[model samples]
Target: MSKSKSKRVSIPRSEAEMPSHVYSQLNTSFRSQDVEGDTNLPPVIRSKLQDLFAQIEKEFENLYNENLNLHDKIDALNEKLEKENYNPERQQTIFESTDDVIPVKTSKHKLSGSSQKLKTAHKLKAQTSKIVSSFKTPSVVCSVVKELRGHRDGVWDVAVARPGVPLVGTASADHTALIWIMESGKCALRYIGHSGSVNSIRFHPTRDLVLTASGDQTAHVWQAAITPDYNKTGASSDEDIEGGGEGESGCDTDIEGGGGTSTLRTPIAELTGHAGVVSHADWMSGGDLIITASWDRTAGLYDVEKKELVNTLTGHDQEITHVCGHHSQRLIVTSSQDTTFRLWDFREPIHSVSVFQGHTDTVTSAIFTKREEKVISGSDDRTVKVWDLRNMRSPQATIRSDSAINKLAVSNLGIIAIPHDNRQVRLFDLTGQRIARHRQGHQRMVCSVAWADEHSFSSNFFSCGFDRLILGWSIQNIKDL
Candidate 1:
């Protein structure tokens, strides 16, 4: 046991670095005094004790220096933690004094039977569940299926082609948009028409066209071949279609390897009337009209065929951030930075307008459900409110979050995916109950989320972030909720 204890003891630096020496005098003297071993043993032990004192001093010095280094690291970490406190008010403006901030007004009417049931169920489930956020799912754990990394700057938005077409498009601050082949994670086509940051992209509901909104104060409608690799003509051509006048047109006949894509260098239509950056663009259900929300504090309705602005929807006090077309109707909703969102009936050409004021801060994103009976709006105030279209005075239910929401997407299966500034993307049902969390694939603020189709393991929902990566997450089992 004594030998074992000695073996476990650490060697001191002084002993390790001690000068090499041979005790030749002691060897000669000990040889001569072999018969008087007892008499010389005391002298040898005393010499060894003297050597140990020096080593102990050096070891204590090393221990002191190590302690000092540890203290320095602790001080640095504490300083950083104080600077990056969880409360966002310290790092950025909370907009608390924006006196125009309006409280949700009280409505005299009661909720319908379905809404009442939704609110009750959400409240009960939340109360029964633990307060801490858990990442574990009961059946399937969400994971990153693939990481798409081609953008040189932050990716702003992502949209998938209609189900069964393995194509995904992303907008970036590098002044370009890329079409990614989802199966192989390769960039298939590069659209380089926008002169400024491309903020949003969406495919036509039924055409082979893709629309992009840009910070250059314009939105472009470009042709994108539906084939797997965009090799329709089999040769590079400079052929310009009739309406592709604003940008240049060129094509690469042979696709390159190592995640490279052919370039579609032109846009077929340029919708250009906004005074500021066009923030978002989407095609209406009929595919004949396009609506765009812009930082100019107005929404523009454009005729796709004529490539002209038809009417401007007004009434927001700040920049509009997002716009979504109704699933089956001629109506559209526009979310704005003015802490409100407005609904417009395109059937009346912007004459029939109603504003919904519920969020306390900028409304970052808003979209209608599949049935058009409700709208979910996310805001900078860290809350998502579900509003019944028939009653805009108050929200049917509110899903409060700890961080600001950047964007949200409601899937065809009625599941909502909301991406937050805290690098987490959470899924919630329309009733406001959180079903699952996807914390696997992002390292920075997640800016956008999109669904390829219904909730299926084969059909991935995507998210892009300020980390310059797009992560496709598999979350089919979330439907178990």
Candidate 2:
């Protein structure tokens, strides 16, 4: 072999780069003379190359599947972030914008049919213009104000004084009733005589007297000087009047030495009789009779002139929460934690004239409106309902609120004030249209709301769970009555 060494034929660099097995197979399939001259590769070598291509194809498929799975994971994370970003305090807007798309064509040769092309372009332009014009803008307007703080220990009740007077009364679990002045934005006075938490306070229709119901099982009358018109001199010049002949001598003498202007600060009387806590009390239209509801499941009528409890009305199976005398003085309405509202005839010593039983939760407050022919009630079921006195079997209208409604007051201008647990004071017209919403900064829950006049309103809204702060709001507007 050394004598005539057969030099190994060198393969081209491109074929030499393959595996030695592939090169060996290629070499075995063809003669050296034929491989040098032939343009096509051997069948065996081609088969090996095909197997390598299939392996690469499978690897690419696996990589593509992994990329798709990563994409799905990213999409899931993005959706979760979007939901977290949504804020309930912000107003939601639902509107879309439409912008027409136009296509442009560029060619070396111009169109031979100019009329057809021009007509098509004009049609497209018209369609785009129409779409742009039809696009709508958001038309809804939302109030920028939000709820402030609410009470913590639970707001028992609220009342507003007469117009132009910046005073509001709030009863609370703190065992006191606070008088707030809007002008000074400070608590003007605290009526602190009740041994327990005060449940309610109501301003007299004409006088500066305020009546408060307390858990101490008693009601107190507070006299605050609203104006100088109140008699302070205590001088009786009409001693021999018509109805006041000889018996008036004692009455005149009693009124003569009552005091000067300080008499207005003295409580007119303290009415007591309820076996349980007095939840609510109110003065009648004439300011002569006071109606009070108690947790003993009974409501009582007090004769202010006689300074004695007149009648005891008992029917409710649970605690009585509220009571109101009719504007005509012929009837009375009451609400209870037993989920019922009853209409009573004060003159007839019989049964209730009608019974309202639609509320699914405890009725906490009730008021007679429309000259005492209709009644409005607020309940823990988060609803405010209006009912006709004639048909108390069902409610005529039910307005749903965001939270439990504790108090309802119908303003003289036909606006209804609803104080809710969301620390909001809402104003609704008789038709259930929300006209205004005020954010109260109470830290706990808003217990009550009342209107002093058409142009003024006050809330005895406070929170004990917060900082034991009481707040009052006064709003002014130029809208027609």
Candidate 3:
């Protein structure tokens, strides 16, 4: 037992850094005592000392191994830094803030229905991947293409039309949604129905509809005045489709259009059932169904045409902070303040198909990758974890961040955009290797970001934040310099 206890004690690596003479003296003294074991020492005490020395030797071995591992980590980090061309000045930026600082709002409520009983089996599978010993920070170039400023308050979410239509929608704390023409940066339409802050926004996968989730505990679906073919042809201007001439400056504080026949603000449907704030909402690829997560600790499945709630997903112990549904599969994933994310087969929204717990703090955002086989999440703990839907036991990989990751966006190319509280946006590959970072992109916390299309290598994306500005970023490949 004494020997086992001694073995459990680890040697301090600091001792190895001491002068060589000190270590030699200690070793020689111990050896000399062993030679004189025949004299003066009590037998029991001698046995205990021998056990202690054996334990020390074992601990030394462990210390040596640990030192090697640490050195490897250091070398990997150095290589990554060099590859990214890392500079302290580039990672940080000067800020100029006004009164538009947007404070984070948190809310909570109980699940609406506990009247029914449900049963589900818990199962887990194992997964494997290449061990990424360190973060792979890649080099990138970012250029600001447009700066849209129309919202009176901070902007919380931005969603660009998929592929063809060069249109962007922004949700703001000003209690309105603005649809902008990307090329001209003109606000095409301003939706003014939400009674509270618009927390999230999304464009329909195959239609001219835009969905906005608000702190008013409702989700509004608005019809955009663009032709279906324009949504598939990557049109540059709305003048040909809408027959509206140039209206205002791209950075003008004034919106472009007035109440006219061309502009529409009335929503097709207003789905309201949550008892608390609705933080996130998304449309399936079919554009027929909508999914939402709310502070009521429940996820609701709604029929877009019927404009009514079809089912309620309840099981989370805390507020459902964010939700994303698969574009191709019948699955949906949600993040919660309970520091856990749950994956549910939307066909059966009554019970969670799987529960993923790894985040140490509130899980602020989660999204399904293009393949619908994996889910990635960001948390207040300043880390992003990726999980395989098949293997629900442990995360496949964990990407560390310098600050809390407030939002995460994944493109079809397997690239991930992480908006952080430190006023920076970072992009990474599916393998957890950081490929690029945009430091000068925002003057305040980057509240949200979204890709313009499904192109794997598309250079253009949109971002908006507490700075009350909508930004378009175009990525460029760097020439050898």
Highest lDDT against the true fold, candidate: 1
Worst 10 residues of 1 by lDDT: 18-27
Ranked candidates (TM-score, high to low): 1, 3, 2
Q: Which stretches of candidate 3 lie over 4 Å from their true place?
A: 1-137, 227-253, 256-264, 347-352, 453-459, 478-481
Q: If scored against the real structure, what TM-score would every candidate get?
A: 0.68, 0.57, 0.66
Which candidate's TM-score is highest? 1
Give the distance in Å from residue 161's predicted Cα in candidate 3 to where it truly belongs: 1.4
- Ten residues in a row with the worst lDDT in model 3? 117-126
Candidate 3, 1-481: lDDT as tens digits = 3321111122233442221111110111244354565567877877787789889967875764465455346545655544354332332221112112323442322221211111111110011112121333346677787788788776878888876667788988777787877666656666766877788889998777799998888999877755433221112234323323344222233553322213333567999899988888999758899999888899999999899999888899998888898888788888898989988885654444688889888888888888558888998778998888788788887887656687688876677889876567888777776677786767656788887644333337888877788888876543221
lDDT by residue (1-481, candidate 1, tens digit) is 3321111112222222211011000111212233344554577775675567668757854754464344335545643443333333421232223323333453434334444655655564455333222212334467788788778777889998775566788998777787877776666677878877788899877766799998888999987764654333111235532212222233222222222355565688889999987888998887889999988899999999899999898899988888998867898999988899888886763368888888888888889888558899998778998888888888987887756787789877678889876567888777776677765577656889998654233537899986789888777565555
**TM-score of candidate 2 on Cα atoms, chains taken together:** 0.57
Residues 373-477, model 2: lDDT tens digits: 678888877788877766767777667664567667886655667866544567665555555555435533456666555323333222221224455444444
Assess candidate 1 and give its TM-score to the true structure: 0.68
**Steric clash pairs (candidate 1):** none
Q: Which wins on lDDT, candidate 2 or candidate 3?
A: 3
